[model samples]
Target: MVGLTYKILPNLTAYGGYSEANRAPTPLELNCSSPTRPCILASTLISDPPLQQVASHTIETGVRGNLAIPAGGTIDWKAGLYRTSSTNDIIQLASLVLGTGYFTNVPETLRQGVEAHASLSIGAFSAYINYAYVDATYQFSGTLSSPFNPYADANGNIFVHPGDHIPGIPRQQLKVGGDYAFTPEFKAGFDVLIVGSQYYVGDDSNQNPQLPMYWVANLHASYQITNNVQIFGLINNLFNNHYATYGTFFDQTTDAQFAGNPVNFVSDPRTITPAQPIAFYGGVKVTF
Candidate 1:
């Protein structure tokens, strides 16, 4: 990795960086190669058909500055752009069994994004906002065959086309928050986070319905009782909005069962886990 930074003005700075990274496959990926002989949990499995490591190259650039406000406060802002490409990217393929999957490698993948944030403070009151937009997609064309492919035909094969959006990754997100100091001993703040939707796993062809976007709110407060003692409280998921951070659809039933008496059994093909509900936490901090 390499980086460079230059001060363009008294309060402004510009920076850029480049990095290369690699990741080796795990033992599970190396061993799980055939769908016919699925390894159940708690069973012994040996690594077979060694896998290749994934290699990535990335570049990023950004600028940030602080501006003095007429009211004796200051505003800080920054913006950045980044791009990364990876070869032989390892990915998980859903299996016929629920909560189980195998790993495979894509020929290539790309992710590029923009990010910006700004914060303002005028006296005890302050506010900040941040936003990011990502374009993540596969850069290779091929066919993926798996027992869990939701779009598979009778033979269980799904075609992966270039530019398919990777599943479970939000393409856009935003966060805005502000805090006010009631006094030297007390403060309160709140924040809202928004996440955009993307394609679902097992639907790499981009033919399935995408997950819906959602947002959540959070609140926090703090008070100091003495120079060395303080108390804080937090309430997350203020509205209790239901959402899922990750999700995928697959047929959880085995092939033999489906072939024997397909009409005698009913299966819920889509599985989803819900996000945490509204919760509260409080704590005290003490310093010597």
Candidate 2:
């Protein structure tokens, strides 16, 4: 497939674009400063620049194919790709809590990723395996980490731009699962999901030490004793594996202050509660 897009607009000012122009500073600054720290009392102004005409465009293309097999069975395969590039129409002026002493413009960023999968099926039995990979990230050209929060700053100062490799997104993964019919009256299936270690979002660091990859297995089986009744069982995290699907690492948490926390720029990662604690359920499944 292929596609195109277009947009138009004019450049605008940054967060602290107008400090003394178009409007005067608030009375707080006029009264708070004592000629010693004028900057500390001054309030920066931020307003969207006058609307302007802008232009935009996009292009995409890909290919796909499939095939069939005999004995009421089939195998399939395909591949495709897309490329997109876009830029905001207006030039945005921004402020900095660190004044000219720190932070700078946020660099333009580009991200791309791809995925593919295939499966086969015959009669009541079928098997499938799928995998996807992505490398989405943002790049900052002339700025460093600014701990300041955006919403709290009124002057637009506090320009805090962090570096690349955001946490939570994985770079690579692999999965495989299949099921078959046993005498048609009895059937079973299983699945396993695996993920590689990720990074923590803050301070821009590899998450490996905090987030580790682990395998989770699942099992399901069912047997029909009559045309209208059957028995089935399900086991998730079959081995009662202890793993973390999601958690947080804090360096200044209460636990860190007392438990002494891990040294060497260390942090205490949160614990995750699993869904099943090696429990079981049995009952008769009915069919009409």
Candidate 3:
């Protein structure tokens, strides 16, 4: 690993770095490489096949600075760009069997992105915002089994090509929050997170409907009661926003209509785990 930094200005600095790393395949990944003999990961191990180690190379550069407001507050901000490429990257592909998958190495994969953050402070109040944009994709061509995906070929295999967006990774994300101090002993803060949409799991071919975007907000407060004790309150999902963080294809045994027909046993393939609703909690913290 190598890195360098330069003072471009009185209150500004520039930095860049490059690094290389390698990771050996885990026991499960090393042993589960057979599509003909799928194992219920951790519960069973049927086949053992050697896999190449994953090697990653990364590069990053950025600029950071601080600015002061003559009349009131000060702002600190930084922005940067980064890219990481991995060779022989291991990936899990869903198989024809329900709730099972096998791990194999892909030729190459890439994850590149830009990130920026800024914060302001004025006397007893401070606020901050952060945002990131990512472009994650496969860099090789291959075929894998995805029986649950509607777009899979007749033999339940999907072909992944170069530049295909990887499943379950959002392209854009943002967060904004603020904190205010009513007094030395009392303070409160709130934050909202926004996430962009991406392809669902098992949609490695980029042929299925992508997940929808969603946002969530939360609030928190704290009061110092003594030198060693304090009280706090939290409210999650402030607006009771409905959302799902993860989604995948599932095989349903029964159809929606339930018409007592033996042949109609395929319901919606999309399955999701819902996010939490509006909830509140209070607690005490001791510094002892």
Ranking of all predicted structures according to TM-score, beginning with the best and ending with the worst: 3, 1, 2
On residues 16-70, what C-alpha lDDT tens digit does candidate 3 reach at each position?
Answer: 9999999999888888887877777655666667889999999999999999986
List candidate 1 stretches off by more than 4 Å.
26-45, 97-99, 252-268, 286-288
Error of 1 at 173 (Å): 0.6
Mind giving the per-residue lDDT tens digits that candidate 2 earns over 65-178?
444678878765433343333232222221232221111123333334455566778887777766656553544433333222222234322233323554556665767777
**Which 10 successive residues of model 2 have the least lDDT summed?**
12-21
Better of 2 and 3 by TM-score: 3
Which pairs of residues have clashing backbones in candidate 3?
A: none
Against the correct fold, how does model 1 do in TM-score?
A: 0.85
Q: List ranges where model 2 is wrong by over 4 Å.
A: 1-62, 69-72, 82-111, 141-163, 183-186, 203-210, 223-231, 251-253, 256-288
Error of 1 at 267 (Å): 7.7
After superposing candidate 3, which stretches have Cα over 4 Å from the reference?
Answer: 41-47, 254-261, 265-267
Candidate 2 has what TM-score? 0.53
Q: Score candidate 2 by lDDT.
A: 0.47
Model 1: ten consecutive residues of lowest lDDT: 35-44
How does each model score on TM-score? 0.85, 0.53, 0.92
